[model samples]
Target: MEYMRTVGRWRRVVRRVAAVAAVLVPLAVVSVVTAGPAQATGCRTNAHVYLTSVYPSSYRFENQPVDGGTDDYQMFAGDSTSFQVGGNGLRPYTSPAWRVESNVSGSFVFNGRVAGGNCVANETTVGLARHTVAGEVWTVRANYLTGNSGQFIQNQAHFRIFFVDPPPPEPWYWQPCYYAEACF
Candidate 1:
């Protein structure tokens, strides 16, 4: 009779332990599986400058970096190319003007007025690049000269700038599981 009682107590203890483990083991696994990739703590935005031509003509375009370096790229008419404006660290709500030069000559017309002369003609025309934060990206646009004659030249080179923001940080509970194995 005593042996039977002892066996019954042992079974109850085993059942309790199994029930606790059933709950905890799955919880640990779910914590691990549901935990996603680490996210950036803060928002770091970057400016990307894109250049496209409206007219179907090829012209030489140059991009001057913020750190005082120059890169030349040839853009075909109705095509686009992109580059980052600010080097590694980009400032928010800042407009960084880029030095864009083209071999084509003429006066640039922007918004119904002659904005500036061509880089080939004046050699000092700097595109007044401006940027605005639109959601996760910063948008920038500039107009430059294109074509041969100054008589029929309009703003041919169109620059579009975008500010790319970093992805949002992970949830509060997921941080511990992602960074440390203590949650498991």
Candidate 2:
């Protein structure tokens, strides 16, 4: 009789525990389903995009005044696609600040930091410049939206990171005044 009672008590305890778990399990699952991947905040204004590496060989990706430029050479700034280094206006100041209408997809429009044309990647002639990369701060899987026809290449990498930052200020120049100009 005692054995029967003990068995009945265990069965009741199991039933109670399962009933609690049945209610809690669904809530936990529902929370996970509702939470999805975070969205990209798009590009910033007046920002300088640089390789995340600090090595001397680490270089900034720049554009040629060609029909378009790199964003054509490789998918991300850190990808292993080697290319010809140096081109016309392939300097740091010449490389335009990237403005994204979306995260790292669709079109990566230039902030017009450079003149004439912006998104030109002439793979045939003056191709993009790449350096002995060290590492990248972050990355972007962006498809080059050429100002020219048909578009040259598209960046298809899923999720990635690239660093786009504001250019650091130089303390050399006095902002309020310039050469030979008297202070007001």
Candidate 3:
């Protein structure tokens, strides 16, 4: 009976050790594998675009951080800031929806959509060039698309572009496990 009890106790100890190893070994391996090359991407930084209006509906300037993050845009009217538009694809020459003019400084055009419209206003000769502000600004002109000014009316609309930072690179790692006296 004494010998039997000793054997049972030893078996239980071995089983308990095995259970602990089963859970802990995988965790250790994962930690080692994932411990390398952890970087903060745009998602981590909340990077985005910023804008300020010198005068309401008169003139405005926009700024975007060089880093890749939120891509948020903050628009100001008087003393209040509202959401104008924001995203991650409004770089100088990188974004497809925008075109940069050489002659005009900071000049840009919205080849894409504005407020979900095709941006086909009456004066279709709209070309956006960056303004002289420290950030990004555009000088916009409205010309009649049909060449008739009397019949067509001209309207001024204010819009801003917001761009976020690019995403960070992903990391890779390996995992290993150990079981009591056995390596698995």
Per-prediction TM-score to the true structure, in the order listed: 0.26, 0.26, 0.23
Model 1 TM: 0.26
- Model 2 C-alpha RMSD vs. true structure (Å) is 19.4
User: Which candidate leads in TM-score?
Assistant: 1
Best of the candidates, lDDT: 2
The positional error of residue 125 in candidate 3, measured at the CA in angstroms, is 39
Tens-place lDDT digits, model 2, residues 23-84: 99999988776553211112221212232222222222213222232231123443232222
Residue 106 displacement in candidate 1 (angstroms): 28
- In model 1, pairs of residues that clash are 138-163, 140-161
In order of listing, the candidates' clash counts read: 2, 13, 21
How far residue 184's Cα lies from its native spot in candidate 3, in Å, is: 93
Question: Higher-lDDT candidate among 2 and 3?
Answer: 2
lDDT tens readout by residue for model 3, 1-84: 999999999999999999999999999998877665242111222212222222332221122221213212322212212222
